[model samples]
Target chain A: DTAVSQTPKYLVTQMGNDKSIKCEQNLGHDTMYWYKQDSKKFLKIMFSYNNKELIINETVPNRFSPKSPDKAHLNLHINSLELGDSAVYFCASRKRFQETQYFGPGTRLLVL
Target chain B: DQQVKQNSPSLSVQEGRISILNCDYTNSMFDYFLWYKKYPAEGPTFLISISSIKDKNEDGRFTVFLNKSAKHLSLHIVPSQPGDSAVYFCAASAIGANSKLTFGKGITLSVRP
Candidate 1:
């Protein structure tokens, strides 16, 4: 069983299209997060949810939205996806604030 | 702006030697520092961390050292193994930020067998 998992590990879509990346965690954590790793290998946190409530929202584009239906799941939906959005998106979970975050295998998105 | 920086993009070490990865942060607001190891297709795995309150924390062969005065931290792996070959990312965040980690550019560590 995967402690943290994401679906469609590989994603290929055209620019301006809409796509979603699904994530789930079984660690019984209180917080979940979404991070984007760019081509230069820079990882940046996009959003974090605590107990199904939005907690941290970095200055990411409005096109990137994070929806957490429950404590264990956080899904990312990108609208009007741009070529610059081509990167590996990672999902993670944490027990609480400032705790270690367990990450998923990542979804590699390629925008053509 | 990149608050966390990993100046070295890559490092090579011989098996059984010690591997040291350095990180620096411009923002003193960062109260915690962590190092993560990532393989090809998988996400990063937590390697070690050090809180701002402490200077050092050890786990098995890995040890994290933090120097708050210098705004610097490092991950030291003793007797580096081939399996440890991966990209290592240095991340940091404030305690109240709910784990909003700002990660470095990452350093690819290659342990030569």
Candidate 2:
């Protein structure tokens, strides 16, 4: 069974388009996170939610928003995507007390 | 600014030899450190971790050593196999900080037979 899964493993959209990426975890984790890995292979955290509550927001632009409908699901929505938004987005989850994170396969986004 | 740094972009090692990947951090607040391995088209998987209090952690062929004074850490894989080739990431996090991990640009390791 896949512990963490992300939908639409590949996405290609034009500038000014709106897109959303869905993520779900079956590991019974209390925390979920969204990360952006750029072309340089630098992985950075974008947002983190614990039990559906926003806990960490890493100075990301307001155009990007993360919503967690429940403890098991966290989704990312981009408004008016720009060319600079093209990158690999990863979804991760971890238990409240566990330090190790479980990551999904990742979604490659290309905004032309 | 990046808090975690992996100076080496890539490392090539022979099979059955030891592979060492180094990482450094600038933040003293970080209390936990971890190493993750990633393959192409796949997300990173947890490989090993070490706490700030301990200097070393080992799991089978993988061993992580921590130097608190230097704020440096390294992952040592002994007798590396060809299947062990992948990009390795170093991550750090502070306790009670919602477990937010700060990651460094990964280093690619190629284990050649």
Candidate 3:
């Protein structure tokens, strides 16, 4: 079984459009994270949630928001996407005290 | 500021040979380091890791070495197979950082038979 999964594997939208990516984990993990891999192939963490509570909010723009409906799901919502928003968004999850994180197949976003 | 850095962008190795990937970090507070491998169109998968207290870790043909003083680390794959070709990422996390990892630019490894 896929421990972590993401929906909308590919998203292509125009500038000023909004988009959302969904993530789900079945590893019974309590912590979920959202990361972005830019054109330079640098993967950076944007937000982290533990038990549906926001724990880490990096220096990301307010246009990007992450919502966790429950411990098993975390979704990212982007408002007024720009060309810079075109990159691969990855969702990861891990146990509260564990160090290893399981990642899902990334969702590639292209904002023209 | 790139906390973690993989200076090399790519590495090519012949099958049945040892492939070494190097990484360095600038943050002294980092205590945990990990290596992840990713294929095209997929997310990275955990490979090996080492803690600051230890100098080396080994699992099968994959081993990771850590040097706390130099803030350097390396991953060695012995007898690299063609299937081992992928992009390798080096990541580090500091204590009390809520498991937030700082990743390097990643090195693409190509194993040719």
Candidate 4:
């Protein structure tokens, strides 16, 4: 069984268009995270949620918002997407107080 | 500024050989370090990790070494097979930092038969 999964593996949209990526985990983990890998291949964390509570919010812009409906799901929504938003987004999850994280197949996003 | 750094962008190794991937961190508060492996179009998977209190950790053919004073760490894969080729990432986190992980630019390893 897949422990972590993401939907819409590929997304191509124009500038100013809004988009959302969904993530779900079945590892019984309480923490979920969103990460972005830019063209430079630098992977950076965007947001983290623990038991549906916001825990870590990086220096990301307000245009990006993460919502967790439950402990098993976390979704990312982008408002007025820009060209800089073109990158691969990954979803990860882990147990509380655990350092190791399990990631899902990334969603490749292209904002023209 | 990047807290974790993987200076090498790629590495090549022959089958049954030893592969070494190195990583460095600037933050002194980082007490936990981990290595993750990723393939194209796939998310990273956990490989190995080491804590500040220990110098090394091993699992099967993969081993991770940590040097607290230098803030440096390395992953060693012995008898590396062709299937072991992938991009390797090094990550670090502080105990009280809300489990935030600082990742380095990954190094792509090519294991040849």
Candidate 1 lDDT over residue span A1-112, tens digit each? 8899999899999999999999999999989999998988788889999999998898999999899999989999999999999999999998885568889999999999
List ranges where model 1 is wrong by over 4 Å.
Answer: none
Q: For every candidate, what share of the true interface contacts is present?
A: 0.80, 0.80, 0.72, 0.83
lDDT of 1 by residue, B1-113 (tens): 88999999999999999999999999988898889999999999998888889999999999999999999999999989999999999998888746588899999999999
Q: Could you tell me which residue pairs clash in candidate 1? A: none
- Give the lDDT of residue B60 in candidate 4: 100
lDDT of 4: 0.95
Name the best candidate (by DockQ). Answer: 2
Return the number of clashes found in candidate 2: 0
Residues A15-88 of candidate 4: C-alpha lDDT, one tens digit per residue: 99999999999999999999999999999999999999999999899999999999999999999999999999
Candidate 2 residue pairs in clash (backbone atoms < 3 Å): none
Q: Candidate order by DockQ, highest to lowest? A: 2, 4, 1, 3
The positional error of residue A84 in candidate 1, measured at the CA in angstroms, is: 1.1
Poorly placed runs, candidate 2 (over 4 Å): none
Q: What is the DockQ of candidate 1?
A: 0.76
DockQ, prediction 4: 0.79
Ranking 1 against 4 by TM-score, winner: 4
Deviation of model 4 at A102, angstroms = 0.7
Give interface RMSD, per candidate: 1.4, 1.1, 1.5, 1.3
Considering lDDT, which of the candidate structures 1 and 2 is the better prediction for this target? 2
Model 3, docking class: medium
